[model samples]
Target: MGDNDHSHPFFLHHSDHPNLVLVSKKLNGDNYTTWARGIHISLSVKNKLGFITGDIEEPSSSEDPDTHAAWRCCNDMILSWLLHSLKPELVESVLFSTTAQAVWDDLCERFSQSNIPRIFQLNRELATISQGTSFVSAYFTRLKGLWDELASYNEHCTCSYGAKNDRQ
Candidate 1:
């Protein structure tokens, strides 16, 4: 993959036939365990900005104050760092899974006019697609209007990161 091309693994329950692309030649060894349960794996689609980043961690119910604080800080730090690195000009409208729609909604509302270059969820599936580009496979098409609104959101983001590049 080139500097601009990145891919991430997205998982689904063993019986779930998710449509997300899987770039791997074969499933990971961990899937062997799930294979006993008949699970398959595939590569996830990538967008201009990058893939919709997701992580799998052991579920925890700990609600300690310090834990929550650290978690929140880590989340912000991750997004802040990505914004610095990828510096996406415009993010696609999100299409998060039902599991994450509320969070996606909050993001859309928070970044509504701000063009920090993030996608918003327009449907139940989290595919990072454009508003209407099949509503299925467009990750950066939402950027169509980026040039028109970037100046306004860049001001909200207040950073020089990826501010001087354009598609050729």
Candidate 2:
């Protein structure tokens, strides 16, 4: 078993299974940003980020049979994990995708578009958030989450003046 092989990109533990829910919340089309971050963190921890990132390419069938087989096994596991994370309606769209990277790219293209209404909603929530009956920590957490989501939609300026102003 390659479970103990930390250097191998396709290493999988005995417990790693397709039915494992990587993120608590399923991808339902509206929460792509947070859903993507959660999926990314989970896959990174599993040493399978390369499968979705296209960093790990599949071996040609003409290559060593064992190597190609191993790649296919890992890829199918990743594809299953991804499909399991999505809503039932969404699963059909990418169910036939041949590679994990293809499935990931399809989902990203479908849901990660710049949504103006969503950005407006996040900004509104940030502006209206208050402690109310919530504890200070809880209030702060809600506020921070909204800010972070809104920040994800923003484009950071790379100019020297922008950098200087940000530091200030």
Candidate 3:
């Protein structure tokens, strides 16, 4: 997706993950579930980010938390998790998002200017990518609002059309 042009960037560092996790656990009644949404994102891009080949999860069967503070912490952890987990290839361009403003501010504070510029660029490119209706992109359009809010997966785009479309 290369046409969209609205990117909201924040900063992140590699060391914040475990500290966030521990702090999140201490204050929350339902420790893991508090961070469930962020964990979901982590699980989806586990391979894309590389270093995090697997999930460090929350209990799906438990009661909901009393507040969203745990989720806030989870979002922070997800960044650390991705930075530490991504394979070298994707590490330079990983993007973080959430509806929450606090999380956004946290990100802006952590990453250096050089770490993930591609992520910001990708958001700007997304509107264009969203316009394509290729077979695969069509599939995404069909699924966008149906399967767990497609907006959550910002990096996904229409699949490349094969050799017939190739430039000479």
Top lDDT model: 2
lDDT of 2 by residue, 67-120 (tens): 888889999998898999999999999999999888887776656663557877
Report, for every candidate in turn, its global Cα lDDT versus the true structure.
Answer: 0.28, 0.78, 0.34
- Which digits, one per residue and each the tens of the lDDT, describe model 1 over residues 121-148? 2221334434663553344555444432
lDDT of 1: 0.28
lDDT of 2 at 42: 90
- Candidate 2 clashing pairs? none
Alpha-carbon runs more than 4 Å astray in model 3:
1-66, 95-168
Q: Which candidate would rank higher by TM-score, 1 or 2?
A: 2
Candidate 2 wrongly placed segments (more than 4 Å): 1-3, 124-143, 154-168
For model 2, where is the 10-residue window of minimal lDDT? 156-165
Question: What is the TM-score ranking, best to worst?
Answer: 2, 3, 1
Q: Give all TM-scores, in the order shown.
A: 0.21, 0.76, 0.21
Measure candidate 2: CA RMSD: 6.5
